[model samples]
Target: MERLQKVIAKAGIASRRKAEELILQGKVKVNGKVCTTLGTQVSSKDIISVDDKIIEKEELVYYLLNKPRKYVCTVKDEHKRNKVVDLIECKERIFPVGRLDYDSTGMLILTNDGDFAQMLSHPKFQIPKSYRVTVKGILDKNDLIKLQNGLVLDDGYKTMPAKVSMTSYDNTSNRCVLEMTINEGRNRQVRRMIEAVGKIVSKLHRMQYGCVKDDNLAIGSYRRLRPHEIKTLKKMANEGISE
Candidate 1:
């Protein structure tokens, strides 16, 4: 069972807020009766209709894409630049669970499951995401410890403590490569965190999301998520596991 508004939103009938408005306006009917309350639990067998039209729920599908740089993560881009959704051929409408900046690349999940997306996105869940980052300046142990302890960003929001590990520092190229696993999802967060330490991010790529990794997937390639993988991710998110 799922929330009525979320189910309607996942069905592509309308946004969740719009679905709730329809429900409050008495335009949504469940099993032949109007349901105005939000958070109404509904099963697959429930007959749902909106504005007197029956809603057809799309089959829930999940895909893990090894996102390539230059492609936007949005379902539709107004500028018509490349979108990640175009990389996959699916009948059901799916959207990226979280966003990677236009230049950032790595493991990204796309799904039609609104609840699953919301669960992973909620900060309270603290879904662990790992990234490979290359920066301009070498960070010493104290700087890395600052990152591990948390740093205040430009916007005045302090980041949560992150798991940091040094990959390599090339003296010839003056670049520092490191792996950071953070559970919070903020806009351009990893970049901002590096900047907080007076370093500029030259490259950023996600290596893992929850237990899902980009091991065998090639750049711009995607595959349907296995049932067990999906189950494990859901479990991790619910349990706030940061591995």
Candidate 2:
């Protein structure tokens, strides 16, 4: 037996937090009766429904997608714009682990396992993500050092220390490419960090997430997670930064 919200989340109906909201709204029913209590438990034999529609657990599926720029990382877009899930031809309903800005692109993980998604998305997990960023102005060693030491964003939130290295620079264009590795997932963080340092971002691409990398996967393409990859992710999620 498990909490109703947990079961609903595991079935991919919604995240655990969203499932709780559904229960609070009197939309979830267990064994044909409305269940609004937070800690209600249910077993496999119990029937679950939301708004009179029955839901069942889906077989878990994991996918690694090389997201292309201009694609939104969401299950549904109000503007009817193309979403990352639409790019994949999978039968199971899988949502992105977190988010990548519509203008930025690269490695993204999609999965039906809500628990796994929660683990990866949670800040406490401190999952490392790396990005290759191009900016309009050249960044010097001091700038890189400042980034490594952390900075205060325009929003006044102090960014955690990040690993920044100069990849290359073009004198003719007055542009530079740098790589950054950070464990915190902030909104437009890399761009904001560069902006805080008096540079403007021109292009951004995520290159890695936790132990996963682009691995030569073509942009706009996706592949199944290998058994070993899934194992490693589970271990990382469980052990966190200690691993």
Candidate 3:
């Protein structure tokens, strides 16, 4: 006994969100009766139709992308901006696991597997992300120590201690590249961490996310996750998914 929207999505009529819209508009019918409720449940044996058209189930797909800057992580943007799914263009209805801000670029995982997505995105599963960031000013020894030792933010929340190290620096540009690893994914956490030390982020890129890599995957390009990769992600999800 699941919501009708889930059945419509599994039957390939569109995404669950789209299915809900159809139901609200009185376009969905179950056994020749119009159904408009959001929580209407239908079993496998029930006859469901969308605008009098029959639907068939679609196979789930999982994919990963080396997302570039200026792209939203949603399925479709309300403002008609570019999205991650437009690059992959799969038939299955897939969505991003978490989110990367408009200026942030990194490895993003997309899938139609609801259970796996829910588990991985849940706060209980501490997923580590390694970011390669280029900042406007050079970081001194004290700055590094402060970052490692942890500092209080202006918003009155003390961030957890993080692993921060210098990768390289260009004296000409006066820009320094640093690698910061964190387990929790908070809103604009990396940029905020850099700002805490009076440094400005010039460029931000995620080098690695959990087990996913940006190796050989160019900006804005995506590829289907290999079988083993999917299996490993599932195992990680299972570790945190509550019964």
**Model 2 TM-score relative to the real fold:** 0.95
Q: Per-residue alpha-carbon lDDT of model 1 for 1-243, expressed as tens digits?
A: 999999888886555666788899999999999999999999999999999888887888999999999999887789999999999999887888889999999999998877788788888899999999999989999889999999999999999999998899989999999999999999999999999988999999999999899588999999999999999999998898776
- Tens digits of per-residue lDDT for model 3, 137-243: 99999988887777777787777677899999988989999998876677788888889899999888888766778589989888888888778766766674222
Error of 2 at 117 (Å): 0.5
Ranking by TM-score: 2, 1, 3
Stretches off by above 4 angstroms in model 3 are 1-43, 46-56, 240-243
lDDT of each: 0.90, 0.89, 0.80
lDDT digits (tens) for residues 1-243 of candidate 2: 999988887887777878899999999999899999997978899999998989877998889999998899889889988899998897887899989999998999999888888888888888889999999999887888889999999989998788889989999999999999998898889999999889999999999888888568999999998888888877887887822
* lDDT, residue 160, model 2: 79
**Cα deviation of 204 in candidate 3 (Å)?**
1.0
**Top lDDT hit:** 1
Report the error of model 3 at residue 146, Å.
3.5
CA lDDT for candidate 1 = 0.90
TM-scores vs. true structure, each candidate? 0.87, 0.95, 0.76
What's the CA RMSD of model 2 in angstroms?
1.4
